[model samples]
Target: MTDESAAPVSSGRRGRSGGGADARRAARTATTITQAGFIRRAIKPYEPFTDEQLQLIEDNAEIVLQETGIDFYEDEEAVQMWKDAGATVTQGNEPRRFRLRFPKGLVRSLIKTAPREYVQHARNPANNVTIGGNNTVFAPVYGPPFIRNLDEGRRYATIEDFRNFAKLVYMLPSLHHAGGTLCEPVDVPVPKRHLDMIYSHIKYNDKPFMSSVTSGERAADSVAMCELLFGKDFVDQNCVMTSLINANSPMVWDGVMLGALKVLARANQACVISPFIVAGAMSPVSTVGTLTQLLAEASVGIAFTQLCRPGAPVVFGTFAASMSMQSGAPTFGTPEPAFVTFGAAQLARRMGVPFRSGGGLCGSKIPDAQAAYESANTLWPTLLSGVNFCLHAAGWLEGGLASGYEKLIMDADQLTMFQKFAEGVDFSENGQAMDAIREVGPGSHYLGSAHTQANFQTAFWRSSLADNNSFEQWQDEGSKDIVVRANAKWKQMLRDYEAPALDPGIDQSLQDFIAQRKAVLPDSMS
Candidate 1:
């Protein structure tokens, strides 16, 4: 995660007197909360692996576990815990690395401890979402160093930019979650930025958001803040936060990530065990080979979560993009990656866990033809592959080096189309409209029919930015490209955004918590 958004741009709301510092402040506090994000109901999912192949992969994964084993580096208790759970654990050739060899069925049984599905609660109860089962939840991009837009060109992200993104995520009805590390705020110190980031999520958006994974302390901060906002009793009893913990490819789970996992799991929160793979560099180049590694890595990571606290909600995530051999840069939204994602989802479903896919990933340098083409390609397959949790759902650009303002709006518009399609067609009697068909008769227009008139608004999705006018009319309206329109769209959203209503007392408590943490932790330049 690298970048952050810019300062809140000019919005439609202005103070009573006119444009000035005080007016800007008044406009910033405009309070409006829309309904929680909509979910994608069941779309018949595509199964890439047949029963025979699925069984083969499972058997192969077991052998891989028996042979290569898994390294639980820097966590001695974890190694002994694995031994206690009936797995063969031994110290690695190097320091602090312990390799675990699971019994034939031990790994699978451990994964079974995870629930089939669970709820991820938001500060606003309305934005709470279900992960797994029949729901498809969309979350925004995570982790980038740079921010890009029409006005700024390219620059480092700051806290102001970060807050602006949270506000936008709150205001935009199309996005499901506010997401984590929407972009890295380099301006903030590394050890302390997480505090600012979590505060931004709490203050700007009432939607569900992710916690930082920089360390166990950072993760604890996430939990402490939640306690202040939602109360300790509620936090302990409910899964109020979900965070991402990426596994080092080739079957290694590092210490920092494991620490965060421990904190989140013991708190009864959720974590997505994602294997960060770029085929040929991190894993074998072949899609099948890459998926095998993805599965093996996810298996052990999920098992660790169960060790932390059995029955902790967990998601099996796959990020199997490829790397360009010539430049060593990552490639996204390509066929190899798609195949890996499809196969991974099949495996996760086989294990009965919620599955995640990198949402709308693309390698395009700009939000141009390449970006749209690649993003659309990725989104369609991700939806069809039965992805339960979609991260990087919108605004991912330049191989995740930066987050784009226009790209977020464009990807969101495309998401609307996919969301509609994922809901599939209705089969009810009224939906079938046999009476309307009979009444209309042969060759008659349905446009003026009773059924059409009654269901017009709800029947079809209306695109916010699509230009559907006739050629002459569109020309008369001034021909515009997708870029120009997307730029205008995002800016207008920022302008119109109002902070969702947050209770003053709870808000103050959160502020005090952050201040106390900062005072003790002093700025570490690392």
Candidate 2:
């Protein structure tokens, strides 16, 4: 898109010309102090498990692999690997099943090279987003098979649903990344679903992108599709298109997901190995117990990536939600989840890798009192405590199993607040407001002064929620709730929405490809 507003900063060129010398110096200085402070406040230093414990877990993982097995892949190489690893490989016309072996060494290696802090590439190099630094990116919540259906794998997902959610994402200024595949429609062919989602992303927004690990083969195809649409340099120069790989924690790796990691490595795409360790489900009941399970799982995933491709981009994706035994479901927006978010951030720091967690996601069924309190209370602490990236920023209600347009807008506001908070004021001589204060006098207003007028835009956060109107005017306006205001704002943005103008021929190429794929599907399906 020819957006003058999105152009790279001239200062950035100078900074790079110095080969990031200034950045390196700043990073080193900040790291040293932060590390020292972290040590003082950390709940416990990261300690490796005893050899006996490690052996037991490994043996148990093997047992689980043999008993419960993972599904997908009919490739010969995969079949052979499964056999070599002593997994029972079953070949079939449909999806195949295979056992997985947990390699401790591979797990350790992924952890070692995983970067603690790094910038993800965007199609526009300038659009790169950093994680594990002062910057934190927020994206929409993902995975609702049906927008409102309570049943799993029963309701079919439609293209209209995808487009509606994409439109919502486009309007959210605080959502810096697009969380791919918010819902998987059963009606859409599995092979084409990712492509359909990407088409929506390209048509709707020009931000960082992500993908779901539907399968290893699909992961490879997804990366290929992105390169075909974007460019070969897309992964290196543009925002990161990260693949999400969920590990069966307490157990090191799931074979299907591990295969996807290999595919991502071959493509040189960055990925977030997010292990959703539900306390009392995949992990122990205690917070420490859960943290340890997450660490072990993350370390293994990180190690695998580096082993296959050294320096391969990866983040320690930790989403630790506690399970309510009463409901037997993962609880979102609770104190335990918030605690895990903070602890995970600290843990990722110790391991020197980026961390990912939830945001604005509450188990609340609606965007009401419960939703507001849950989102604010959980997100504020997470952002302040130094989380690098928030994966589920918007469109979540009912514990992240549903998406609501109004809720997405409210979440966007929350994200904006967090961004403002992260940008703590610089108190250097130039930043001090002493001169402006002196000029205004104690009783006089600074509202009309040159200094006030000049700096007001950058000096404070103007809320989309709080009323700055006079009390009399506010009372006359009916005092609508924040949700009502947000809904109105969302509709306005949609009316004014403009698709980014891509380089000549890029959009056409993408459209043509989609058209070709559509032709292959049944007429009714198309």
Candidate 3:
């Protein structure tokens, strides 16, 4: 478990003291923007819904919003905000249940204020990406309470495991954002875990990362740390940090999540106004009905963000999936979620904000046949579904209960195929290959031809983990399976990991800010 080669850069002390030859070299050693597996496909992914269906979904969603109204629970500030934004607000007799119906054209007008596409700036400028339109950006797994692997089985995740995952995210080129909660590092105290998690992300990866949503204070700490990493003024101007703010499904927004939502939105950071719903449980089991609720809920959350501050960035996030009625357990990678993915994304486009969904999601206990089959099903459509920001791009298993190290590598390998798929086809002179075709003339091998020699290196999508050897040759290589190979690959990645560099002063200040905030907050768990 000890990795001396790429020991995590100390959050307490990283980077050189000042500008010099040494500092410049250190900066170069840091992971620069090496492609984040996104392809701006000339040919867009195949969308499922037709004009009539799209109209039905949108019309019904607007009906839900304007008539029944969405709930804004337990927060007077939010209630007043909604009321001020032209919603008819009223409190239910029950505690924490507030309902407000929007005017017919309100949500649409609110959505129009948001940009159709906007750039999410990274600490390393070259890593910046446009989050809407044809672009699809991949991000690592978010919340998981445990870590799982063939060797480790299942256990509460530790700081060590979290750091290793961050290193893996740093090394992996497919993942665009080094997500906020790779897992809940239970080893770190709950009250202070955000400090360590945020520090690990800030120090280990130069890619654009997420902010803390555990509490308003933690969320504030994330902004402060961001301000330290990128300057306070620069961050205020650019959309740097994106946070997940989930609406408690069956129509409610919790106080704590709203706290983070407000802080991130007001500062001009982005929020994925997601509703973490199970279709059969928290929502109506029928696909059309569920889509209606999904859109309505997102409309309310998006309206809330604009209420927080007009022109703030938001993603119309969809996490609705079905449940196995037999066991009452959550299900993923099924036809229902795939249905939800395409439908929800279509709805997101209609609403005109960017969307986020389709992670490497599944409900399987281990990285077995079930896990591979389920995850692959979801991933293929994710590229085609017009998902703008793909969260949980890797390392997810057991229905988001655990972050499997081996699964992370395997899922990333899947992303390579989709990134290629997203690129569609090329028909330029070389791609058309008229001359090469004429030379070959429909017969003999192209292996030795001038075309093959010229394009061989770039012709194929190569996988580092998938085995292509014959059975006899495979047995000679220890008869390894995917999980076995993945184990070795992740360990080697950690061994090769170098903590991406930062300016020394920025590094020190980030650490200092974390320390100062930790000092003030009581060491208490929520």
Per-prediction TM-score, please? 0.91, 0.75, 0.95
What are the per-residue Cα lDDT tens digits for candidate 2 across 206-296?
A: 5567764767766765666566555656543443577688886655455677778778865666778788787898888976556656665
The lDDT for every candidate, in the order shown, is 0.82, 0.62, 0.82
The reply for model 1, stretches above 4 Å from the true place, is 1-32, 36-40
> When superposed on Cα atoms, how far off is each prediction in RMSD?
5.6, 9.7, 2.5
Tell me the spans in candidate 3 whose CA falls farther than 4 Å from its real position. 1-22, 28-33
Point out the worst 10-residue segment of candidate 2 by lDDT: 31-40
Q: Residue by residue across 1-526, what tens digits does model 1's lDDT show? A: 2223222222211111233554356445656566535665666788877889877778888888998888888877778778998989877888999888888888888888899899988876778899998778888889988877766777887777787677777776668888999999988888889999998888777788899998999999999888777778878878878789999888898889998999999998999999999999999988778877788889988988998899999999987689999999988778888888888988888899999985888898788889988888888778889888899989888988888888888888888887888778889998999989998999888999999999998898877777888999888877977777888987887776666545555655667888888888857668
Structural RMSD, model 1 = 5.6
What lDDT score goes with residue 222 in model 1?
A: 97
Q: Which candidate is the best by TM-score?
A: 3
